[model samples]
Target: MLQKKLMLLGGLRYLLPVIEEAHNLGVYVITADYLPNNFAHRYSDEYCNVSIIDKDAVLAKARELKIDGILAHAVDPGVVSAAYVAEKMGLPFQCSYEAACILQDKSLFREFLTEHGFNTPKAKGYENIEDALNDVDYFNWPVIVKPVDSAGSKGVTKVEDKSKLREAIETAISSSYSRHFIIEDFLDKVGAQSSADIFTVDGKLVYATYSDQLFDPDAANPYTPAIEIWPSSMEQKFQDDLTAQLQRLFDLLHVKSGIYNVESRVCSNGKAYIMEVSPRGGGNRIAELQDMATGQNLIQNEIKKALGMPLDNITAPEYKGVWCNYILHSNKQGTLASLEFDQEFQSKYIRDVGLIVKNGDQIVPFTGANSSLGTLFLRFDTREELDSTLNRISDYIHINLR
Candidate 1:
């Protein structure tokens, strides 16, 4: 039997599980990116030097690698490239290359949603800061400005006044690789936003789950979510409706087998809207958390889909507990900080914690997913326990910084 070959675009840490699993299954995994020191490369069978964002270059490299399949899970910059390579090489793809292009670009996505009559925010894309500033007066207050192609909330901001539009636009443009940005109506969060991970097999959704995405008002970036609680608080009817809408969207776009990380909301307007639909796994190990809660390995299914292996794990999710993943970060820059929890805290509720930072390590202010300190997984027996614990988190959790 030949060792199956797999190519992973972009060497992000989140790709580690895919590489390890492939290795365990006796598959030869090749990791690719311009950076030689990206941590994921340390675990791959081979490392290839190539820019993941350049689709043509990546396709050429993939063909040269003679790999069986390709994936860009948890790496937004590599999604289009992965799709392009797979489409060109007659391998499996998450969606059509054209659909990938529409999904990857914020401007294009918003336009498509509106044109297709989806529940969407009023948004406009701009390449000219001056033009955006001139048109800023047209939008309502508290509009969100963000880079069109960037993810992890790198350059997302909410502006309350016209005075801040130029600054926000500059920040977004600086953070964007393509120097394009979008300004959109900011829907008032009614309860909590929803960010979820769902799986599809053979152009059909197989499993779906969402979480109530919570934010910290005092974080360096107020828009960045501080935590996520699984089994969303949204009414079951809305969840079902959102699932139908998402399935419709995929069907219309002809999305194929893989995982989708979606950001959406059931807002103050009493309408559910999808803010983003990226055909890849999410940051913060959302799929991993789902696996932990449901005893199903979406990572395996995602890898199998991309690599043309038999789909064995696709099934309706059977949840076990109410879980949450804390997006740990500091509101200020610091060094030599201590994260301590009460003695009873761990025994009572804390399931697992991975503090990515160490004592005396320089910590950046909470800005986006890139600045996340680590992930803390917690499980509770009931919704009340989960809510109470999260509501008074500072009581049991301490962050002492110098």
Candidate 2:
């Protein structure tokens, strides 16, 4: 029998890899979340109906079970709770509790970065409409408003007109569980944005990698990531500089060991900027893709740390080829009937496709990350081939929303 028990926060299917890894390591796996039918529960040894965002409740459950470690992968709301329980229990922790709280709160994170001399955008946070309205003119013309602590790009609004300020603030607050929001100047990204992961062991950075975050400007929310490509098309020199800056940030935060989701970009000002850095595996199996491209097993390492085991070699990522992950979305709200792709897509471009929704399942209008109904992965032989295909992907495939 596996004696060590690992408690995972949230049973989203994204954690299936972590669950499988733990099972293989002979570690008892348990899942917790408000949803009982999260599918991943079927693979867990036991399940608990606790709200992942409620730290005290989850910590109580963890104590009752006497779990050896706690992890919240790819779920933003669960990160703070998992870190809190680990800190209180004296178990292996990703970072100090104080640092984890700052990383989880968008406003605090931005403040920390700005104070530390990192390349970031001017930003402000507010909890109410009046306060945001009063400070609206403080920024440039075009701006972005979003929930301070929300994930999956929910409640993010692009406001180019002052008349839309109140509406944008309301939308962001509605999406935020904390009822807090942040407003920042909309940066003109030099290339595509970057959404990737960095791993550190004992306050020493071991792995740092990034990808080009592609988006569907025609989608309900233009800011939501549509596709992300590994081996970013960014100039190699820019990537190198960003990597160095992140290592310094990791050390400043005293991050000992954990997987972090980082978003950055080269802006129109001809400088690379670090937009966001959160301590958790990102949504959409981003780290999983990196694991596939490189030989590192980040999923296994995350679980291993919670169990107080030595981490796997995260030395450096070795890209075998160019790869991309696409989020399948629908432009209309209706039942999903089918996703049809041209013969060329099936025969030449797409490596694999996965539909999170079943035939006849409800498909919501493409809005944020949550609206994605499926995933598409691609492997291209050359950078030029990858760029040309992404630029004209929609012409080759279509999702039918009945």
Candidate 3:
């Protein structure tokens, strides 16, 4: 029998686990992206140099390689391209190419949600700044400006004054590949935002989990998620409602078996809203952390689904203990920095530390997810201990610069 050939878009470090799982399954893994120096390429059976954002280019390469399946996984920019390639090749994919395009673009996604009667923020998408300025009155005060086609909060800004709208628009346009931006009413969350990876089989929701998504106030981009804790603080009633709504949305989209990264929040208006739902794994190791907390291997199941293999039984996760993933980052630019952790804290809570940079490496302010230094996985026996430690995180962990 021929070994199954799997092509993965984007060579980010997050793809390493996928590569490992593919290898274990006796599949030939090919990592493709424009960058040849990406770390995941080192582990893949082959590396293809092609722009993942260019669907035609990726399709041509996948045809040349004769791959059996393709996946974008944690990389957001390549989700549309991967879907296009998979559809062109008649391979297994989570959703259709049209569905992927709609989910990947913020403006299209918002319109779909509103049209489907789901609770969504009032938003407008614009290709130029003048039009958005003219329609400023359409939104409520304290709106969020963001790129329509970017992720990891790279081009997100909270604007209360209209005078700063142009600057924000420029930032959003610069970050967007399509040079488009969206202005939306910012829903003031009643508690920490919820983000998680959910799974569905043949358009039926099987597994769902939620986390408390936290942000660092001192970071350059305060919207970027700085930490995530499992077993969300949201009321059980809201969680249940969101899950039902999400399943309905998936059925409307005709989604197939696969994993999705979902973002949601309970607003101060005494309502719940689904903010974003992308058909790919979330960045910041969300699936990996979920695996540790629930003993469910979403990564492995995702791979199996991509390859058209039968998936293992995937059920709702029941977390054993409180878990948190702290995205390590700095607030200022510097060089030759050494990370410090309190000995007692490290011994008690820190389960693993995955550092991306060594001492003497240049580091910059935490403007986006790309600027993160590393991630720390922690487990606690009680929510009180988790809250107390995270509230005073600065006292336990420090990033010293030379």
Candidate 4:
């Protein structure tokens, strides 16, 4: 066994790659989270029962274990806390606690970009309906309102009228931790946009993959991602330009190591507006999808970067493939009596069936992808195969609710 011990602060869903790579590398992995049944904990050698938000407790535990390096790859909430432990222990961490805070919080990030002269959408942050309404004149209608810290499209609302502004602000603030919500001028979704996931070693770019989002405009609520497909169908130049912009941002931010997910949009005129940056890999099934489209093992590279080890060269695979994650959701809130997936589908490219909501569990009223029943991850050898499978899966699967 390796002498180095590594500590991870997120659950299995986020730490799947970290745990797998660390254990494979012969390092002792310690998984910590609030939930006892978290996915990653099941695969780890040792599990710690603690809340991800409890920074002091986590730091104390790290001291006891003498962890060589700490990481929070896909977990945004724990990134700052992870850096806290690294800073206190004088370990080599990628980003500072202040930088992590700015990246994790949308309001702070917007301000940072504005001050830094990075391309940004006009925006404002509010704590309540009154504050939001007081600044209503500052924003154009159809503004984007969302929780400053929430991810995966939770508590995102697009306000089109003055009457609905207060309600949107209330909903956004309710879902946030700091009672803060960001209201930004909605950008035109013309042309193309993609979420670029990149890895850097010693502040230099190593690997990258771009995923195109299938935006659902008329899905009642506007804050859902709906579906995301890898190696976006966009033109090659668009991808290269966006990558260049991200390279600049990475340099400016002084990203030493680990993964970074930058959500950017290519305007109709070809300008790329950076949406946000996370000092970690993307959530949902992005990492898994990237692996399918490209032969590169991102999870392995991320671990090597965090441990200060040299990573193998990462390149896009020769074959073209598509990986899609469909968010299953319902219009109403009720008891989730039962859930089932087609057996044939499971045996095929369908990787696994995961249900965040279980039988007899009460489902809440949700407007977007945040309240999904579960995620359906599909991989295919070709785009044609991917499209055909998506159509078939759409018709065959069922999410029975009561």
Candidate with maximal lDDT: 3
**Tens-place lDDT digits, model 2, residues 185-233:** 8898888899998788887878888898988878888788989998888
Give candidate 2's error at residue 311 in angstroms. Answer: 1.6
User: Runs in model 2 with CA error above 4 Å?
Assistant: none
Q: Enumerate residue pairs that collide in model 1.
A: 336-360
Deviation (Å) of 18 in candidate 4: 3.0
Q: Output the number of the TM-score-best candidate.
A: 3
Clashing pairs in 3: none
Model 4: clashing residue pairs?
12-40
In candidate 4, position 324 carries an lDDT of 72
Q: Estimate candidate 2's RMSD in Å.
A: 1.5
**How many steric clashes does model 4 contain?**
1
Cand. 4 TM to true fold: 0.88
Q: TM-score each candidate.
A: 0.97, 0.96, 0.99, 0.88
Please tell me which model should have the higher TM-score, number 1 or number 3. Answer: 3
lDDT by residue (329-371, candidate 1, tens digit) is: 8887778468888888788888888666788888888989988
Candidate 3 — worst ten consecutive residues by lDDT sum? 331-340
